[model samples]
Structure formats: C-alpha cells, structure tokens
Target: MAKISLDEMNPAMKSKQEQLLGKFEKESKTRQFDHYLLAQGLYWISIIVALYHFGTSFIGYPATHLHRSLHVAMILFMTFFLYPANKKASRKSIPWYDIVLAIASLAVAAYVWIEYINFINRMGSPNTMDVVMGTILILVVLEASRRISGWPLVILSLIFLLYGLFGRNLPGIFMHRGYDWKALVNHIFINTEGIYGTSVDVAASYIFLFIMFGTVMNKCGMGRFFNDLALAFAGSSKGGPAKVAVIASGFLGSINGSAVANVVTTGAFTIPLMKKTGYSNEFSGAVESSASVGGQLLPPIMGAAAFIMAEMLGVKYSSIVVSAAIPALLYYLGILVQVQLRASKLNLEGLPKDQLPKLKDVMRERGHLLIPIAFLLYMLLFSGATVIFSAFWAIVATIAVSMARKTTRMSIRQILDAFSEGTRAVVSVAVACAVVGIIIGVVSLTGFGLNMANAIIQLGQSNLMLTLFLTMITCMILGMGLPSIPAYLITATMAAPALVKLGIPPLAAHMFVFYFAMFANITPPVALASFAAAGLSGGDPMKTGIQSVKLSLAGFIVPYMFIYNSALLLIDVTPLVALRVAITAILGVLLIGMATEGYLFKDMVWPVRIAAFLGALLLISANVVQDIIGFSLAVLVVLFQFYWKHKKQIA
Candidate 1:
C-alpha cells in the first residue's frame, strides 16, 4: 500500500498542490528567483515592522495615529512583491522583472516619502510630480488588488468613483453633484481613507500578526493535528468522515480564518473519504465547501476581519469575540447536523478503530500548542493590549512553545518556511485592504456610505427583515468576486448602518455583514471554496456550488436568527436564556440537516421534510407561538416516519 496521503486518494485534490505551489522548484535555484526565501524574508520583515510600529505608536495605550508609511508599505509589498511572487514566479526565487518592479515600487515610495518632507515644508501642499507619482502608486495598488482579489471590488470601486463623478445626473433618491478626479484621488490617496483609513489601519496592525500566528501554527502541525482530532472525535459514526470534515474545518477555521486555506487543507483528506464511503462526488465536495467556507464565522478569530470589525465599531476586540461566540456556535451546529443527516442517508460507517488516533494520546503530545490561542483570548480581554499587541504575543508564544517539544520544534529550514508562508498569506489581504481603503476614501469624500445606508433603509420602509434581505443580496453580489475581509469592510462601512437605522446594534449589524461576505465564498457563480472542492472530487464545479449552497442552508438562516435574538449572541446573557437559545439552535440545526439530506430515521416524504424545515425555522426563531407550531409539526413528521418504519418492519 502506498499509504493514502490527503490528496492521492482524492482525484479531486490531485491538482491542488500544483495550483498552490506553481513553479517553486525551478525558481528556488536562483537567489532572486527564490520565492520561498523571498517569502521568508518578507515574513520576518513584517514581524519586525509589526513590532516596531506597534511599540513606537502605542505601547502604553492604542494611539489613533495609524501609521501612514507602514500601512502603505504593507499594501505596496503585497501588490508588487508577494501577490505576483508565487503566481508569476517562485517562493524560493524571484525573477528579474520582480526585482525591477520592486525597485520601481520603492522609487515611487521614495518619491512620496521625500515629497512628503517638501510638502510639510511648503505648508502641506505637494507639487505636480509628487501628485503624479502618488497617483501612479495608488493605481499600482488597484492593479495589484485586481490580480489577487478579483474584479468585484475593483468594479464596485469604479462604480463608487463614477457615482461621485456623475451624481448630478442620477435619478431620484440618488442625485448629487459629482466631484472630479482630483477629489476622488485625494479622498482615496492623500487622506487617511482611500489607502489609509480604518481598513488599512486594522490590516497594518492586528490582521498581519494573526496571519503570522497562523503561519507559525501551520508549520507546527496544526493541519495534521486538526485533521487527526476531527477523525478521532467524529470519524467512526455513520457519515462520520463528512462530519469530521465539518468539525475539523470549524476548529481549524478559528486560527486560519481563511475559507480557501481551510478548504485546501482539510478537503484534501476528507472529501475523498466521503466519496470512498459512497457519498456523491458533488455532495462530498459541497460538504467540504460548506464546512470550510464557515471559517469567517468561526471564533475567537474570524477572517482577521473581526479585529477590523472591532476597530470600525469602536469596540474592544474582546467584545467582538464575545459577541461572536453565539453566532459561530450556531453556524457550526448547522453544518454538523447537515453532515449527520447526510451520513444517515448514505448509511456510511466511521473509520474503524485501527485507523483512528487515540484522543488522549494526541492531546498529551500536542496539548500545549493550544496555549497561544488561549493566551491570545486572555490578552484581548484583560491585558489591555491592542488586538495587534495581543496577536504579536500570540505569535511569539506559538514559536516559543513549538521549540519546547522536539517533535514540534521548527528547524532552521522550518523556521524560514513558516516566516515565508506567513508573508505569502498576507498578500491577498494586504492588497484587498488597500483597494477597499480607496473605496472607503471615495465614500467618505462623497458621503456614499451614508447615502447607501439611507437608501436601503428608505427602500425597506423601516422593515428589518426586508432591509436585512436587501443588504444580504447586495453583500452577496459584492462579495462574489472579492476576498472575505475586503468584502466585509465594504459591507460594514455601508450596509451595516442601515441595519443600525432599523434598531440593530452596531456589533450585531456588522457581524451580520461579516457572515454574508464569507457566504459568498461558497455561493454559486463564484463559490471559490466549492470550486476548489470540485477539482478535488472530480465533480462538476457548478453542481458542486449549488450543492454547497444546499448543504450550508443553516449558514444563511443562523445569521438571521442571531440578528433577531440577541440572546443567542450571549448579549447580557443569563444561564436560562443561554440554555434556551442553545437548545433551540441545536434542534434547529439538526432539523435543518435532516430536511436538506431528506432523512431523519428514514427517507422523508416531501410533506415530512417541509414540516421538518418549518419546525426548524420556528424553533430557530425562538418565539413561543412559532416554537409550539414548529415542535408540533416536527412531532407529526416524526410520528409519520415511525409509522412507516413500523409498517415496513411488520411487512
């Protein structure tokens, strides 16, 4: 036996390493061509930048003077260095053009830095050449962002820019005198908004360190440990492996905070086991896609966007994590139930004991690895450190602990690899943040965020659900071609205020927007995670996407549930209320899984399934009248299933 690695058994996963790795081997040979080494250097460089920037700017307390130079540096690095590095070249090497581009980028930055001095000397006014160079730099940023995050954001930004330019010609409710290019550019560039505001601020600070923490953890066996942990916990029951995928992704999601990373990592293993156990290829892929795509909703860290959310709402990072506790649970509960029901439909059995890792043993060996994550939470809540400071210490703790055990210790080579990968991971986020900063800049300059919020509110006529639906639709459409962080940034900046107008709290509204941005990753037409799963499963990508949407039904509903019932979010929670919300949500998730998989105790009729869905919805909604209706209908469906089972057994 060649021993089944995560991907070899998965025809669907066979091409993934190639997709991710590109031409590293050949490129690794040369100094400039060495993508990995370059990545390594950049990672440590970022660490230094993070440390120096955070220390100098806000050691005693978080200062609001968000570093303009450092922030812009990260964006430019991602655009000209990291994003193009692997996709176009190598981790172990750099190409001549990369070096050329690098110098050019540096030159442009130098021009800005030097011009900044002269501008200060001349009473804050810059010259034409300075302005031209700045424009060129900003455009370079947008181009870089386009390469990494795709066109939805770029397109959205253009629309906003056009809105500002041609506001006077717009129809009723959308009319305003449009500004010229200079205003647009200045808003996005010269000010702390377009390339500099809260979006870029959070990115420069918290998001980067956490990303680095994930990188360190990755090399220290988080991937294998997470998989083994899921397998040990859930790999033995019917449909167990699929459930394992859900559980594993949900757990690892807290750290990686990236759906794409979660998908590629866990899908390589679990999707194959699903198919070998008789799960349909598309269904298997969908299961992985849905589960993995839940990363952005996972806590205590989510998509690195939660930190951003805290900054935007002006809340403590601890509060953001605490607020997220409930919704994240419901999200996973939904996936777990779906997996269990699917298992019932397929009649699959979990892996035999011989194949499973002993839970106690796995824990004994690697349990200390959990400390950094814990330390991170505690710091965010109590140490009074900024989120960036907390994440930096967490990264420090992760590296220090990895060395405690010989098995987990990073070799010199491994250390370099982790450093490299951490930098590599930030490329997309850094570029996206810069681009989104531009969007924010434009909105602020033109009052677009407020306008959009008011428009949505007026359109919904003060109806919360209608407003939510509209926001959801808009976010989904906007997120279709963007990364989760940037997608949420835009949503939080615009649509969230509309929810606030409708009496939703800022945290709840922003969290709601955050959830939808992630859902886009698995939504049809642009389900990036599902497409990855499809490649692994040898399944049709579109079918995989649609199935992913079906499997992840609870993801859509849970966000609505939380918005309605703050109790679910542990808002000023009591034990009784917590218990009630937990029970209702768990039951709701189970029913949802059953309805989608069309099985409970047995294959359900359309009527039974519909009843189950209704029951689940009612329970999830947490209203007394609806809960009663839902429970009664669910009982009726259960009785019907029992009756059919008894009849069949007797026959």
Candidate 2:
C-alpha cells in the first residue's frame, strides 16, 4: 500500500528479489558466456527461435514431427549453451563438451525434420541409423529436462524407460512384455508417440504462443498495472496488503503459469508490504504461495497443463476453463477468508488511504493494458476460436494495445526483447513436455498406464473413495519437486485412468488429478512455490509449506467434491443443483479457513475447530442430508462464537 519509489527500495529487498528470481527462473543460473561475440550469437539464436514460433503460429505450423522437432532442437541448443552441466561448472562459460552436445541436439533435430517422410514410410520399423538418432535424442531430451526442470522429472522418465525395457522381468501387475533397448529408443524417439507426442505438440503450438503473449504483456508493464490495480482496490481494507497479494498474484500467476516463478515475482513486492502491514513472515509466505499456486487453477490460461489436458481429453480448451472456474474461485476464497480472519484476530488495520493509489487514477493511466486480456477472453469463450488462434491474436492485441499509451508501449527493441524473453521462459516447459512424452511413450508401449490403473483399482479394492485417495497420494508423490505441467501429465496419464475406470467422468477425473498435481506446490517436503515465497518473506521454508497447505485446504478438497458431485463442475446438473453446489462449496471454504486459522467471531476452542472442520467437509459433500447437517453445525458454531465475542466485549 505504501508507494515506495525505486530509489527508496532497500538493499535487502533488492537482494531478495535477485535471489528469488535467479532461483526460480532457472535460466538465470545458466552460464553467461564472457565472450561478447558468442553471447551475441546465443542471443540471436533465441530471437530466431522466437521468430520461428511467431511466424508458425499465424502462417500455419509444419508437420507435427517437423514443427516439434525444430522446437525442441532450438530449446536444446539454447539450453546447453545457457545451462552448464553442473553447478560447479564455470558460470561465465559453457564447457566445450556442452557445445558438442548442443551441436548434437541440432543434428538430431535436423535428422527428424529432413527425414520426416522417410521415417513415416518406415512405420514401426526403424533402421540402425534411426535407432542411433533416436537414442541420442532421448538422451538430449532427458538432459535438457534435468537442466531446466531439475532431477525429479528426469528420474521419473528414467524409471519409465527402465520399466519399458525390463517390465517382463518385473513382478505382478507391474510386469509387461519387455521392449528391447532399440525398440524402446525407436518408440520414444523416432515416433509421434514419444518426444513429439501431444504434450510437446501442444507446447509447440498453443503453449508457446500463450507464453509469448504473457511475456509481451509483462514487457509492456501489465504486471505493474495489475499490482497497482490490486492496491487501489484492496489497500484500504483490513489486511489490505495481504488481500492485494491474493488478487495481484492470482492475476499474474494465471498468465505466468509457473507457481515458483509467480511466487518470487509477485511475492517480492507483496510479501514485504504484508509484513510491514503486520503479517507474520510465515503467514505472508504461505499466503503468497497459496494464492500464486491457485493461479494455475485460474481460467483462460491455467498453466501449460491445461492445454495438454485439452489435448488429452480431446475437448475444447474453453471447456476446461469453464469447468475450472468454480473450483479456482473456492481455492482463492479459502485463502482470502483465512487472511481476513487472521487480520481480525490480530486487529490489523489497512494502510492509510492517503498512501494508497486512487482507483480512478490507476485505471485512467493503465486501463488499456487490460484490453488484450479482455480480447483474449472474448475470442476464447465467445468467438469459439482455437487456443492457438486466441493466443496469437492476444499477442498481437497486446503489442497494439500497448501502443495506445506511450508509458506502457513497447518499442521495436522492447518487442524483440519480449520475444527473446518469452522463448527463453518457455525452455523449461518445452523440455519438460518433451521429456514427459517419453513417459507417455513408455506407457503406451508397455501398457503401463492401463496396468497401473488396474493396480490402483485393485489396491483400492474397487472402492471409489479408496481409489480416489490412492490417486491423490500418487499425484502428490509424483508432483514433488516437479513443475505442474509434467506433474499433471504424469498423473493424468497414470492415475486419472483409474478414477475414470471407477466410473468418474473423464473430464472430472483429469481435473481431479490436475488439481492434486498442482497442490504439490504448497505441500511439504518439496514445496517449490512455498520455498520461493519463504525466501521472499524471510520465513522458515518448512513452516511456510505447512502454512500454505493449511491455507489451501480448499484446493485439496474441491477436487474430491467435484468428483463426487459433478454439479460442482457444472456437469450433468440442473441450474438449481449448480447454484446449491456453488454456494455450499464457497461457504465450506470459508468455514475451513475459519477452522484452520482458529478464528471466526473470536478465537475458537478446539471443539469448535473440530466441529467447523467437519462441517466444512460436509458442506463440500453436496449431499442434501450432509448439507443439512453441515449447515446446522456451522450455524451452531457461529452462534457460540458470536456470544463468546459479546461476553468478552462486556468484560
């Protein structure tokens, strides 16, 4: 709420910002070549990649194999040049061996593109040269994934690769007819089912453009505008800075789609303000982590996974957005309620009105920045445009709309910078998508997906609730230390089918898996988003993760609610049923927040907290009988809290 100028920002805050951005950005840790000529060449390579994607998005892409191969090739080439093999490697130079690998990546990609027709003609059979190329490509993809996304995904991919090759020797349901090394490599590398599969295709076509759109918007100052708008709207309310974090981070994260990165970018500004306004370090970190993670659940551009989800389910992207709307709302509602309850419990006050920006003035200065987003939504939801078309137009609209205001307009150089940044930003996601394709490749090759689904179903003893529980656990485990895109992909490919086998609708099943996959960002043990927030807030990482889980309880629960009663997802339900589910779900989230924070009208006793928790769960159940019971319990708790507050006031 305090409008501090750039000069007034302290050294500590600046240092925190740099540390967080470096850690989350991934590319920042890459070796920066000291040779000016080499660095300039690398920069041009990134720009060229961006230009390639930009041109393809409008003019039509090449064959899936050709397009995806080129996309991955460019990503790999840049990645090797930028990211050293290890942290101990010199930061100011790329090792010579890495340069060789980079060249190898390009040669392999060129092979795929040049021989696309030849490879297709060969069908399922591959030559020795094909096998060799495929093997190298597989290694390239795995290493790229490891460098960009960390080891979790790479390790997971390796496990799947080993499984594919040796499953016949394994025990029980996990066993399958084994694939030979050559067969495995060919399947995972040379074919469409492997690295060039749907996930990578989605990344190349839809996700890249959207990422570019987001980068363009950011370069044009959209992030600053969103922050200012949030401050203007919420800075005068109780827990103003915290509320601003929820709103602003949610806005930024929805577009950015990387929970850890989102936390650092928005938390850098909001966390300090929240602390200054009386929020605890851990609480401020948790709030930003929870809110930023929720952005992946937000509509229009709900992370890279959403595009993959659309591709997997063969549904319109708009459908996923529509179904996701209510759950995303409830997730944030839970966070907001907890923040507000905490503020009241501590008697925290908002910043002085004079220190806050005026809403009208903020809007007048930067209101046009919102038009591109509005145009994007209109194209997606109303015009029924394809996701790629929507995003392409959105990018154009972003650049054009920026021109309306000199203060916000991006010059030609800035536009090029936006393109380069956008391309660089997507390297992690693209590599992850390519690597996960190997998992999917193996799953399809060895029937591992179906086998795993059956095994889960058997472990649950055919009980739907038990199956859902096991799937949740699996999702959380797989999602650990991984980004949401690959996490969701792995879970959706493996666990989601089990839920579908249990008679859950496909969309609901995938959405259920998707939510839990993303919830990992706030779950303990390896909560990336939470840790990033902790860095910004200067809080204990473990405590921040725990607090994040507590604040985001609704996200963990809403997936099950919608799975149980599809009306919550607006599926197979009347308007009345939809309304009832929506209302109950929102109220349930608020109750959960009160119970988690141990405050409502006043501080609650243990018994009241237990009752509130149970009631919240019941409300989310969406059963008429459960709803009645939950409502009665909630009402009783409210009455007691109200009376207790009154008595304390009198005292």
Candidate 3:
C-alpha cells in the first residue's frame, strides 16, 4: 500500500541487500571503481560494446566466426578489468597484468578475422600460427569464464577439455581416440562447433539484445510500474502481501530472468511486508524465492534460455513461449493458493483498501509502458517477425514510449547508462555460454552426450518413470550454482537425450530438463535465490530453501505430467483435449496447495491432507478415469470439511 522506492529504503536493509547479492549472485561480485579515470574508461568501453551489438541488430550480423569472435573478445576484455582476480585484489584500479590480458584478448579475437580465409582452409590441419592463436584464445576464455562465471563452470569446462584430450585412458563408454593439443585447440577455436558453437552464437545473436531491451525498459521506469500495478491489483486481498510478491516477481522475472536478482530486487520490498502480515520469516523468504524462480519459466523472455531452446530445437521462439504459458501459470497459481490459505489459517488480514493505489490511477500514469511488451509479443506470435527484429523494435518502442510521460522519459545520460549497464550485465552470461560451448564441443567430438544418454537409459533399464527420475536428479545437480542458460544447455546435452531415447517427445524432454534446471535455484543444499531471500528476511537459509520447495511442489510435478502427455505442452493435441487438461491441471495444483498448507475451509486432518495429495497426483495425470476419480475425491474432501465445520459450530 505504501509507495516503494529503493532510495527510501532503510540503510540497514540496503546494506543487507548488497551483502546477500554479493554472496549469492556471482555476477554481482564485481569491483566498482572509485577513480574517475578507471571508471570513465570502463563506462565508455561498455558503451562502445553495447553500441556495436545495437548496430548489429539493425545492420545484421557479420560472418559467423567474425561475429562470435568479436563478441567473446569484448566480453573478455571487460571481464578482466571489472572482476578482480580474488577477494583481496584491489578494486579502485585495474592491475597491470589484467591490462595485458585485456590487450591479449583483442589479439586472440582478431586473429580469426585477420586470417579468415586461411583459418577456414586450415580447419582440420592447422599451421603453427593457428595453433598458437587458438591456444591463447582458449586460455583467455577459460580465465575470463573463471573470473565471471565462478569455479563450478570453469571446473566443468576443464573436465570436459581434459576428457577430450585424454579419453583414451578411460574405461568403458568413456573411451575415445584422444586428439592432440593442436587438433583439440583447432576444433574449439578454428571451427565453429567448439567455442563458437550454438551457445555463443545465441548469446551474440539474441540474448544480448534482449538484455539491452530489459535494461532500457528498466531505465525508463517499467520496474516501478510493475510493482505499483501489482500492488494496485493484489495489495488489498487476503494474504495480499505474499500475492504481491508472487505477482511482482513474475512480472520482473520476465524482464530480468535472473532468480537471485529478482529475489533481491523484489524481496527487498515484499518480504518485510509479508512478515508484517503475520507470515513467518522463512515463509516470507520462501514465498519470494519460489515466485522469483518461476519467472524463468514465464514466457516472452523466459530468461533468454527460451531463445537458445528455439535455436536448439529449430522451432520458433514463439512456440516455446506458447508451450510454457500454462505450466508457468500453474506454478504461480500454486504459490498464490497456498499463501492465501495460509493467511486464512493464521487469520492474517490484508492491507486497508484505502491505503492502496487505485488501479485506474496507476494505469493512467504508467500504462503506456505496457505497449512495448504487448507489441513484442504480437510481433513474435502473430506478425512473423524474426526474434532479433522483434527485440530491436521492442527496445526502440520502449525508448519511444518513455517520451509519452515526462516522468518516464530517458535522457541522453540515462540512455548511455542503460547501454553501459546492460552490456556489463551480459559479461557473465556471455562468458558462461562460451565456457559451456567447450562442453558441447567435447560432447560432439567424443560422442559423450550419446554415451551419457545410453548410460542413463541402461541404468534405468527402459522404465520411463525411473528414467525420468534419474534425469531430474541429473538436471538438478548440474543446475545448482549455474545460471539457467548454461544449466539448460548442459542438461539438454547430457540428460534430455536420455528422455528422448525413452520415447518422450523431444520438446517435452527438453522442457523437462529445463524446468528442473531452473528449479535448482530454490531446491535445498544450493538454493541461491532462497539464500538471498533469507538474508533479506533474516531467516535460516536452509529452512527458507526447504519451504520454497514445498511452495514450488507443483513445478516439480508438471514436467513429468507434460512428458507423460504432451497435451500439457499443447503439442500433438486438439483444442478440446487441451482445454480439459488445463482445467484438471488447475484443480490438481490447487489441491496440492491445500494439501501442503494443511488447510481447506478448516485445518485438514492428516487423512484429508493425504487424500488431497493423492487426488492432486491423479488429477494432474493425463487420464480420463484418473481425472474423474481425482475430481470426486476433491469434492468429498470439501464436503467433509463443511460437515466438520458445522459440527464444531454446534459443539
């Protein structure tokens, strides 16, 4: 109900936000220069890089190798100067060695462009100069990835590289005729299939543009508009604070696509409000984290991973958007219903309606911001525009629309700052994509993806359910501590193939792994989003993570449901069947909420909770008989609760 602004937040809360972000988000742990010369240099360099990508969106990409090489070069140069070598390193100025590395980065990237024709001709048999340049590029990328992406990815990439070079010494399905250093370097550097492969290609092509679009929108005040709009609509209902967290986080997630960032940004405002409304600290943190993680599943942007999926699957990005809509809704719906029920159980009341902004007034002031989003979706789904074309225009539209309201207009300085900030934001992701490209390259060279798929299939022994469980575990494990793009890339390479082999449709299989990879941010043992929320809420991280898992129960199940019946994905199904499936799935998720919350009309008994849980599973499954049985069971529980309430009143 209150006006929200970061500038107005308490100093203690602001410090906590910074600490939590630094601890949980690797990308946020960067050196901020206080020296004017260093700061100005970094700013202009970032602006130049951003301008280059912006120009490409209009002028079109260059040759594949040239484009990707330049992309990696720019990212590495910035990364070396921006991120310190370690926690103890100086922040105010760049180190001399890092400067040297930055300059070397240009040389590594420029060699391909300088020797373009020669490089192409020597792809299989590289000369001495090619090998030297390739080796330097590989080392620079690894070091840059380590600095920006953290150690887990660096370790994983190194392991894959080692396997590529030394697989002959291994046993069983792992064995391969190991290639020498020159051959491996040439494959990864000279050829497109290795470091310059699809992952980096998508990063250079689509992800950077969308990142800029999100930044421009944020600079023009869309973030505040989303918070206000969500508050206007949901801030006065029962359990409204938690509902606001879910709604606002979902809206922000579509733009930012980073769970920890989303949690830290929105949770700073919403978590304290939820706690004030009688929600437990852990519950408040869990609510924010769960809702934030679900944002990656939200269509339109879906964290940039959707674009990569489109690239991988050879389908329109709009198709991923369409298939993702229902499931994403189900996830948020589950959180919303559970929070509402919890509020009822605890007798928590919403904020006063008079204290809330009127929906009309809020829309009148900032509703124009919605135009770019709507236009972007229309172009993607109906207008048949390319993703790059749609994204570029969307950025332009955001800048144009901001002028409609003087309050939201972007000044030249603000525009330059957005470009600088957006380009800085992309460094970590671009590095991760480049590092993951090594893994993809290794898989291609060693047939490791097929081998891993066979290993999983053989281990599961053709039982689809068991195999799905194994794949889910693999995805969650791989996804922990990794951003969703590379997480999806890794799992899609290693685990999705196993599902496809088990007769799961390719889309459903990839979606299955994608869901789990995203969920790892809220799963226990390594829940970065939940930990960030906990820091903001002053709750226990492990408890917050566990509670988040309970809140996100439906997310864990919906993937399997879609795998069992592609109708959930709107694949190979008629409209009538899809509508029916949607209704039952909604009901199932609601029951899951009721079961997990332990309340329906009144506090549910253990037997009733168990029944609700079972009914939820049945209804979620794709079977007519199961749906009927599940619906009947739900009705009986509702009737029983009413009867119990009446008897208690009589007593």
Candidate 4:
C-alpha cells in the first residue's frame, strides 16, 4: 500500500475533518461562560455540588430520596445552564426558558426532598399532585437527556414509556397489561425503582465522585503526564506513535468515561503523530478510537456501567475490576500487535530517539500524578473502602499530591475550574442514568425485561452459543444509539437474563453484555468514538469506523471466549487453567489480528487469511482438541508464509 502525504490527501477529507472536529468540539467541550458574574455563580454552584457529594461520601449519605434528588437536581440545573438546546444556540447566554427550567429542576427535586416521608407513607398510592410532579420530572429528565446525551437515550426512554402506557394495544410478544397514566407516572416518579433507581444511585454516589477525581487529575496535568510517559516508553518502538496512542488513550480513557470525549482529548495529540509516523489516516484514527474505547474495559476506573454492574449484580466493585483485567489487557495487546504488524508490513520507522522524551525525566517531573490512582486502587482493592469513599479521598489525594511538583500544582482557581468542569462533564452521564431509570421502571412494571429475555432464549432455541451471539447483536444494536452506561443497563436488564437462563453464571452474562455494549462505540454507522478520532486524524468516518472494527476484533471475540471458558474471567478456575486460557486467548487474538491486517511474515493470500481466521476461532473456543488443531493450522500457515516470502526474496 502506498502512503499518502498530508498535501496529497484529498480535499474532501480535509474539509470533512474540519467539520467533524468543529462538531465534536461543540458537542464534547465544556461550555465557556462569557459573563464573569454568571461564571462565578456557576463555579460556586459546582463547587457546592462537589462539596456536598464529597462530604456525603465520608459523613454518610442523607436519606436516599434527599441525597439522590439533590444530586440529580444540581446536575440538571448545571446542564441546562451550560449546554444549550442545540449547536446553533448561544453559548454565552442561558435563555430565559432555560433559566425557568433550571429553577424548575430544583423545584422538582425540592418537592421530592420535602415530600419523601409522604411518598413513603403513601407508596403505590400517588395523588394528583404526585402524578403532576412525576410527569414534570420525567419530562425534565428526558429533555435534559436530549440536551446532554443527544436524542437516542431520550427517544429510547420514550419508547419504553409508550410501551408501558399502551402495551395492551401492541401485538405478539410485545403485548402486556397496560397501566393508566397516573399509575405509570406514580410508578416511575414517586417510586424508588424509577428515575431514582440503582443506576442513578450509582451515578449519584460513585460515578460523580470518580468523574470529579478524573477532572481534578486532568486539571492537575495527569493527562499530559500519561501521554509523555507513553511516548517515553513506546515512541522509539515499531509503530511508535500508534503504540503511544494505544497506551496513552487507554490510560486517559480509563478515567474519562466517554469514548468520544476520550478520543477528542487524547487523539488530538496521538492521531496527528501517528499520521506523521506514516500510518494511514483511517488506521491512525481507528487505532486511537478502538484503544480509547477499550479503556472502558480497563480496571480500577472502568466506565460508569461498571459501577452499575456492581450494583446490579450485588458484587463488590473490585470484583468487576479483577474480572476485567485480563480481557482489557488482551484488547490492547491485540491492537498493539496489529499496529506492529502493519508497521512491519509497510517498513515504517519509529520516531527518532532524540525527539522522544526521556522516561526518567518525564517520571521525575510529574510522577506524583500516579499517586492518586495508586491510592484509589489500594483503597478499593485492599482497604475494603466503599468506592465512593475511595474516590472522595482520591480527589483529595489528587489535590494534595499535585503540590508535590510545581508544574502540576493546582491553584485555587484551577481547583474551582476542576470542580466546575467535573460537574459539567458528568451532566450527560447523570441525565442518561436518570432516563435509563425510567426504562428500568417500565421494564419492572410491565415484566418486559423477563419477557424479552424469554423471547431471546426461544429464538436461540436454548443453544448457549447461539444465545450469546444473539445477545451480542442485541447489545451492539442498542449500543449503537445509546451511551455506554444506558446501553449496558438496558442490555444487562434484558439480554443478560437470557444468558443466565441458559445456565451461564449471572456475572459472566452481565459482563458479556457490558463488553459488547462498550464495543458499540467502535461499531459502524453510529461509531461515536471512531468518528471523533476521524475528526482528529483527518480520516473518513466510515473507513475509520470499519477499520476500528477490524482492529478490535479481539474485543468482539473475547466476550464469547469468556462466556465459553469462564476461566478467562477467573471464574472457578485453577491457576494452570487460567494460564492456559490466557495463553490461547492471546495467541488467538494475535492470529486473528494478523488475518485482519492481512500481514504476518508477508502479506497473506486470501486462503491463508481464511485459515488464520478459522484457526483463531478454534483456539479461542477453549476446547483442548480444537486448540490443538488450531495451533497446528496456525503453525502451518506461518511456515507457508515464511517459505513463500523467502522464495520471493531469492527471486
């Protein structure tokens, strides 16, 4: 393949890049308040919100309704003031209607906070006023979701609402006994199982604090330090810039929950360097996007869904992290291997050593930035502290440790900005969680989740593999439109039960759904992360998304591997079995990557690629006989490729 220079690239690509970048920045960047008074007021509001949560984390939470209502109300208030209704809306001014909405946000939350005892006393028996308040809150949550997370989540929640209200009129498997408007509203509004459900509870308690931690860390220059550390480690290797992107984007994205946000943040630097280092624009974009998305699968601070997963499964947060460790490593390893193979096939060289930062210097300068993460891990994994408590202390640790290095210190203004930015960053996630709560509410009211799971089981004819495939497809389709947290929530509620019914453990089923849900960010058509990376890399969006799918083939496969051999997830497996599964899974991913890239010892013929693909499937199947046959096939293909390449060389 020929490499295209920047000047030689098509004009349309450049135009598309600029347009996408502008759109991404408009969508993902925090709003900049122009009025000093408004800015100061918003800053203080954010700080108060942060302090409220931070204090609650240690001092013990208030009543459930009081705490969650106040939490979400503040998020809604900030969201309305910060994010406009549309791109064309003014950034510098909050419209009068928005101000009213913001005030209404507080009023609604206040109503809940004030009437909590009444709500509990009159549970399942809401009055006209309760219904009215519930309706208003529902609408408010939907509108907030639309403003923040885009229309997909809001639309999905609406569909669920419609289904709940009018299910009697629906046909076939969708039919259910319908509830009246008041009944439905009460169930969703006054009930703890509705918008105040577990999803929002986790978001309010755990996710928000962690987002604040990330924001503070970023403000203190942790993001830059991670990038420099990655470059120092990988910038002189084969496909150095690409490898740097995988490492750096993964590190940053682990804390930054949104894949699109991650791409826009880290891809800005990594994508251009990759393009300069002779990777195709599409490949570079795909690499960063896929790697960034994979960070949601990483341990310690995975995506918001992980917190929800723990809550849903009634498992410890550290357990989720432990299970995710190997698969996340394999996902990145697959990406790194593919990039190296591509670089080797193209004879691409790394950046000059003199141009790269020295590892010792980079670490010496900002190494303290790592202390917060280490502290977080220790608190969560070893100290048995609650995730919320751990995150609260981690934020404090971040602020304290930043002062260790003059360059990384956060001043009072910067600390305030971090608070404001952190609150701003969580708006979409908080809204999405609230809206998804409505879906969960409806699912519980109508028994829709169990019905859907049964339908999938019947469709799969109780075949575990077929059921897994069907669930994966459902998750990907749902995820294409929804954000990761909502996607996982919906899938875990609906599709995971099908897997569990088929005799898969609950944890494995849920984890499988979570994996595919996150993968949707790189899936085609609505691949948000890929599109964001394309914006940064000046690549075609469709091409970059497709390349992302290819590059992340292991991610697409690992869920199934774990579902088959739970050893991959460290479930009831001995060390030897875990080691065997890990080895085979890694090798399978390597071969699959080679097949996808169409290069190994040499450019692969179609037959060799097919064989490699088949071999990978067999190897990842985790069957001993299949593994033996697959390993043999892989060896044979490698030898043939090597022989052919040597003969060609002689010629």
Number of backbone-clashing residue pairs for each candidate, in the order shown: 23, 0, 0, 0
Clashing residue pairs for model 4: none
Please write out the lDDT profile of model 1 over residues 525-638, one tens digit for every residue: 877788878877789989999998887788789889888887777777799988888777777777787788788777998988888898888886758788778778777887
What is the lDDT, from 0 to 100, of the residue 511 in candidate 4?
87
Error of 1 at 149 (Å): 2.9
Pitting candidate 1 against candidate 2, the one with the higher TM-score is: 2
lDDT of candidate 3 at residue 149, scale 0 to 100:
62
Please identify which of the two predictions, 2 or 4, would achieve the higher lDDT against the true structure.
2
Q: Against the true structure, whose lDDT is highest? A: 3
Provide C-alpha RMSD values for all models, in order: 3.9, 1.6, 1.3, 3.7
For model 4, the local distance difference test gives: 0.84
The digit string of per-residue lDDT tens for model 4 on 470-558 reads 99999988887566677788888888998988888898899899889888888888888898888777789999999999999988888
Q: What's model 4's lDDT at 3? A: 24
Candidate ordering by lDDT (highest first)? 3, 2, 4, 1
Give the candidate number with the greatest TM-score: 3
Error of 2 at 68 (Å): 1.2
Rank by TM-score (best first): 3, 2, 4, 1
Q: lDDT tens digits, residues 429-537, model 3?
A: 8888888988888898889999999999988998898899999999999998887788999999999999888788888989999999999999989999998999999
Higher-ranked by TM-score: 1 or 3: 3
- Tell me the lDDT of candidate 3: 0.89
